[model samples]
Structure formats: C-alpha cells, structure tokens
Target: MAASDVTVGVIFLAQIFVGSLGNSSLLLHFLVLDFTGGRVRHTDLILKHLTVANLLTLLCRGVPQTVAALGMKVFLSDLECKLLFYVHRVGRSVSIGSTCLLSSFQAITISPGDSRWAALKEKALRYMCSSTRLNWILYGLLNVMFPVVMTGNWSHRNITCLKDFGYCSAARHDTTTDSLFAALLSFPDAVCVGLMLWSSSSMVYILHRHKQRMQHVHKVRSPKSSPEPPKPSSSW
Candidate 1:
C-alpha cells in the first residue's frame, strides 16, 4: 500500500476506536442509571437512542473504510452490500430524527405552564418510544426499494474498485428511480432540520425570559450596597 493509503487507514482506525469507545461508555452510563435509579429521564432516553445510532453508523461506515484502507481486498455479494447500505441509511435517519425529537421535547417541557404543550409534558416519555417506533417504520419503508438499485457486479468497465468495496454500487443511473430516492432521503432530513430550528428558538426565548425574571427578583431582594461616607483618616 502507498504511504497515503496507510495514513488514511490509520485515521479511519482511530476514528472507529474513539467513536466506539465513547458511544459504548455513554450507553453503559445510561444503562446504569436506568438500573440503579429505576427510572430514566427523557433526556437520558434520547441520549441512549442517539448513542445506539452513532454506534451503528460507526460500524457500518468506519469498519469497511478501515479494512479497505489496510489494502485488504474485500468483496461483498449483492445481498451483503444491500443490507449494509440499508443499515447505514436507517441509522443516519434515526440519529437525525432522534435529535429533532430531543430538541422538540425539551421545548415542550420548558414551555409556560399555561401553554397547551405543558399539558403534554407528562406524556412525553411515552411519546418518545412511540416516535422512535415510528421513525424506524418510516425509514424502513422509505428505503424498501434501496436494494433494487444497488448491485455487486464487478464486470462493468465503468465500475472501478478504488475505495473499499468496489463491486457494490449504491444506485444505478436511472433518472426516475434516482429522483424518487433523493426525495425520500431528503424529506425526513428536511423535517428534522425544521423541527430542530423551531424548538431551538423556542428554548432560547424561554431561557431569555427566565433570566430576565431572575434578575428582576434579585434586584428587588438585594439590600442597598452604597459605600458609606468616607470617614476622616484615623492618623490625621
């Protein structure tokens, strides 16, 4: 292998090592909390989901790339390629959707007591699981057709084995299928982005108002700190 390829391999390995360790540690911590404390916070639950997603992503992408970088020629059959690609895509979608859910949940949790969202606060945990289930279902359906587009044929002259698995192509050049796939992938991500931004802004506004209220209370309760009139020097 060339020096550049060795360097790339090292980097990929480092990424996999650090990422896997971090996600594992986080998931372990959350599991401990759940077992010892006998309850899991909404935030903790969301974090657990995110950690799982990250681990999946790291495994799906990093392992293959790292192995390839090491100059080991690995070939995947069509079935393996399709399954791997599907898992990677689903993991990415779940990560994004989970993040959006976390943000929106926090926003609702912190909303004014009189607001309509406050009523749903008690049910948020239940909703979290439901939303996650829905996330899986939605992404699973969205990518159901993914395997049809991917191929592991190595005979095609246009297909080159430059990267890790050269035999597997993610999609063919069919315009209609490509367009539909693009739309399916982009739609959920767009929704996630929109929800994140909206919830983030609401949380910011709530925090700002809370800070102002605290400052006002502090000012009212604080005793006067005016300096005493300067006394004549004792050594005069």
Candidate 2:
C-alpha cells in the first residue's frame, strides 16, 4: 500500500509544488535571455540543467507518489520503478551536493587565500556563467551514474525512497550493496551538513563582530561621550 505520514506528507508535497514552480520560472527567464555562445551560455546551461533536475525530481518522485498516495502505485513497471526512483534519488542527491559545493566554493573564493580562484573572483561577476563550465562538467558527470547505482538499493533492498526526492529513509538491509549505497549516500550529506554548519557559524560570528563595531562607533559619537561635568554651575 502506498502511504505517507499524513500531516508531514501534505506539507512536503505542497513545498514541492511551490518551490519547483518558482525555480522553474526563474530558469525560464534565464533561458529567454539568449545565453551567448560563451561562458555566459554555460551559466544558462547550468541553470537550465538545474531546473530540469528539479523537474525530474518532481515528476519521478513527487507527482507519481502523490498520485499513488491518493489512490495506488499505478503505471509502474519494474524497470520504470527502478528508473523513476533512480532519477529522483540521484537528481536530488546531486542537487544537494552541488548546492553545498557552490556555497563552499563561494566562501573559499572570497577567502584570504592568494590562490588562483581567489584572483578570479573580481572577474567572476563579469563572466559568472563561464566559470562554472568545469564545475558543471565535473559534478554533472560525477552524479550522472548515481541514478543507475541507486537501482540496486531500491529493489533488492528495503531502503524507502522519499516522495519529495529529498532523501531516503529505510530500514537496514542485510546486504553489502545496500550498506555501500547508504555509506555513499551518507558521506555527502554529512560533509555538506558539517560544512554548512561551520560556514553558518562563521557568518554569524562576522555579523556579530560587525554589530559590535557599529555599536562602538555609536558610543563614540553619542552626545553622552563627553560626560557633563556634574552640572557644576547652574542655580544649585
């Protein structure tokens, strides 16, 4: 039987529709801009690719399962099942990893390191799309096989794939293959989580310091800076 936790299911499904639509529209705008056959073109390509990935995520994961939840798991062949679930799984995983990589890359790019990438930061704004060619190619290929690799775990194992294509929540399978997939799955999540947390903390710290500096400036400029000399004269 196809089922999901009621309240949780409703909220998540809603999120899928809302978020996907908004992103798709933004992607369309970029597409309409006529990405010139340069680095600019690659930016559009990557963004368009991301949209397709998200669309695949919604189609292969969200819509089908939501329909199933409303009725039954119809229109599913064993092959379709594998491919559908595989596409959802891989596309989502790649999305997460890519986002993490993007954030970390930004942090590093802006870092004090005198590395080559840091030097390119000033020029990045002009050709933001061009810089991502290598990034898109490498990561795009790295995760291309994820869906294929996911098939083994989906069928021969008990790993439960989520409807939102966010992540899989599954019971343990007494098989090496399943375990291996789980490990592969967990590594990126762990690294992404750790890096995000660390990055967030640093950002928070910087903001706090900035706040203190502003407060110090205010203190220095305030009229109270020159403590009134006890109102010595007056009518007292």
Candidate 3:
C-alpha cells in the first residue's frame, strides 16, 4: 500500500477507536444511572442522545473509510449501502440538533428569574424530553431521501450519473430536485447552528455581566483602608 494510504488508514482507525470509546463510556454512564434509579439531569438526557448519535456517526462513516484505506475489497449490497447512509445521516442531524438543544437549555436555565423568562424556563425544563423526541422525529423525516438515493458501489458502474461515497453511491438528481433537497437539508442545519451560536453568545454575555456585577459588589463591600493617625514626630 502507498504511504498515503497507510496514513489514511491510521487516521481513520484512531478516530474510530477514540470516538467510539468516549461515546460508549458516556452511554454506559447514562445507562447505569437509569438502571440504578439515579437522578438523571435533563442535560444528561440530552448528552445521552448525543452520545448515541456520535457512536452511530463514527461507526458508519469511520469504519468504511478505514476499511477502504486499508485496501480492503469488501462489497456492500444496495440495501446495506442505503441503510448505512441513512443511519449516518440521521445520526449526524441528531447530533447537531442535540447540541443546539443543550446550548439553548443551558442559556434558558441561567437566564434571570424575572417573570418574562420564568415561564419560558419552566417550560423548557418541563418539556426537555418532549423536545428531544420532537428533534429526532423532525430529522428522521427530513433525511428520508437517503434510502431512495443511495446505492451500492456495484450499482454505480451501471449508473451514468452517480456521486461516489466510497462504500456507496447516490444517484444524481436534476438541478431543480437537487436544489430542493439541498434547501430542505440546509434549512434545519442552518437553524440549529444559528440557535447554538446565539445561545452560546448569550451565555457568554450573561456570564460576563455577572462577573462585572460581582466585582462591583466586592469593591463596594470591601473595607476601605482607614487613614493612619499622625505619626509621632521624627526624633528631635
């Protein structure tokens, strides 16, 4: 094998191993908590979902690339390719949405407890599970086109217009169809990313303001240095 191929294989292997290990650890922790009747925080629940999604993404995307890089000639059937791509897409989307949800949740949790945001915070905490469930459902439906478009490498030879994805290929759609699908996929991702950024920025701003207020309070409450009484005259 070429040196580049060896390097690629090693990179993929490292990614797959490290990513799987970390995600699995988080998943096991969550599972143990659930089984032992431990109090699981709502944030933990979101992290659990994110862990699972990360695992799926690593396995689906890394394993194939690793095998290919190693000069392996494994062949996947059409069904296998479609299923793999579909699962990978869903996992990726879920990961993004989970991150966004987690950030937004934290922002809401830390916001001032005024009447304006009190109800919003309560609703966020109360519907955390429902929100996650809805996230999964929405993304699952959004990427439903994968199964229809994806095909095994073997089929790519016969298809004139196909986009190769190493272990699989996707049939090329016309410009209009491609544009429509691209819009559909990009819309949710854009929204999720935007929300994540906005929430993260809000948290930073809130923390900064809090820190300034703390400094101000500390300065105000700190004892002022009293002036020393007039010292005795120097030795005559």
Candidate 4:
C-alpha cells in the first residue's frame, strides 16, 4: 500500500476509536440513570436516542471507510456497500431530527406562560417521545430509496451506480437526479437547524428579560444604602 493510503487508514481508525468511546460513554451514562431510577429528563431521552444514532453512523460510515482506506481488496460485497450507505444515511437523518426536536422542546418548555405555544409545554415530555418515534419512521422510510436507487459496481467496487434515467446500465450515473434527491433528503436537516437557532435565540431573550425584571424588583424592594448628598450641607 502507498504511504498516503496507510496514513488515511490510521486517521479513519483513530476516528472510529474516539467516536466509539464518546458515544459508548454517553450510552452507558444514560443506561445507568435508567437502571437507578434517576429522573430522566426530556432532554436526556433525546440525548440517549441521539447517542445510539451517532454510534450507528460512526460504525456504518467509519468502519467501511477505514477498511477501504487500508487498501483492503474485496473486503465488502455489493450488497454490503448498499447496506452500509443506507444505514449511514438513516443514522445521520435521525441525528438531525433528534437535535431539532430537542431544540423545539426546550423552547416550548421555557416559553412564557402566556405565549401561544404554552399549551405545548405541558405535553412536552410526551411529545418528545412521540416526535422521536415519528422522526425515526419518517427518515427510515424516506431513505429506503437509498438502497433502491443504488447498485454496486463490482468492476469498480469503489464507486456506486445510482439509478437515474432508468435506462442506462453503464457505470456513469445521472448526476442531476442524484443531486436533486440529495437536496431533498437534506430538507429536514435544514428545517431542524433553523428551528434550533430560533428556539435558542428566543430562550436567550426570555432569560435576559427575566433577569432584568428580577433586578428591577430587587432595586425597588431594597433600600438605597448610598449616603445621601451631604444634606446640602453649606446651602442651609
């Protein structure tokens, strides 16, 4: 193997090791809390789910890339490549959905009582669970297209041939259709990121206002300790 290939392999392996360790630690912590009857918060639930999704992502994307980087010949079959890509895509989608859910949940929970979304705050915990399940299902179904559109090119095992025009059997795949689908699949990620930004911003504003209000109250209730202006000493 070339020196460059060996270097790539080492990097991939390192990524796998570090990513696995962190995700495993997070999962372990969540499990410990669950078993000990600790009050698992709503965010905790989302985090636990995220950890699992991240681990799957790392495994699917990292391990395969690592093997390939190591210059392993004929290590994976066509079916295996399809499966790996599918799982990686699904895991990534789930992570995005979970993050969006987490942000919205926090926003709703911290919203002012009189806000329009206040009603959602009461059901936040229940919603968190249901939303996560829905996200998984939705993304899973959507990504089923991955495997369907994808085929392994055994002759050039390094590349995948994605079905586009429905007629061409050659190694070259349709780039336009592939790009379109990719953009479509990325919609959820974009939406989730926007939601997170909005929610976090609103939360920050609310807290800042609350802090100001508290400060005002403290000033009103507490007597001013500063010495009065010398009682206009000389004017008298």
- Kindly report which residue pairs in candidate 1 clash with one another: none
lDDT of 1 by residue, 121-227 (tens): 88886688888778778877887776666655442336442222543565455679668768878988999999999999999999999999999999999999999
What TM-scores do the predictions have? 0.85, 0.60, 0.94, 0.83
Model 1 RMSD to the real structure?
A: 3.7
Error of 1 at 94 (Å): 0.5
> lDDT at 178 for candidate 3?
94
State the displacement of the C-alpha of residue 215, model 2, in Å, after optimal TM-score superposition: 2.3
Candidate lDDT (C-alpha), each: 0.80, 0.58, 0.89, 0.79
Clashes of 2: 1
**Candidate 2: tens digits of C-alpha lDDT, residues 21-119:** 887897777766765432353235446656666777777788666655554434454466656776776667556654554555455454544544567
In order, how many clashes per candidate?
Answer: 0, 1, 0, 0
Best candidate, lDDT: 3
Per-residue lDDT of model 3, residues 101-185, tens digit only: 9999999888877635557887898899998899889989999999999998876657799987777888997999999999999
- The Cα error of candidate 4 at residue 107, in Å, is 1.0
Query: Considering lDDT, which of the candidate structures 2 and 4 is the better prediction for this target?
Result: 4
Clashes of 3: 0
List the candidate numbers ranked by lDDT, top first: 3, 1, 4, 2
How does residue 200 of candidate 1 score in lDDT? Answer: 99
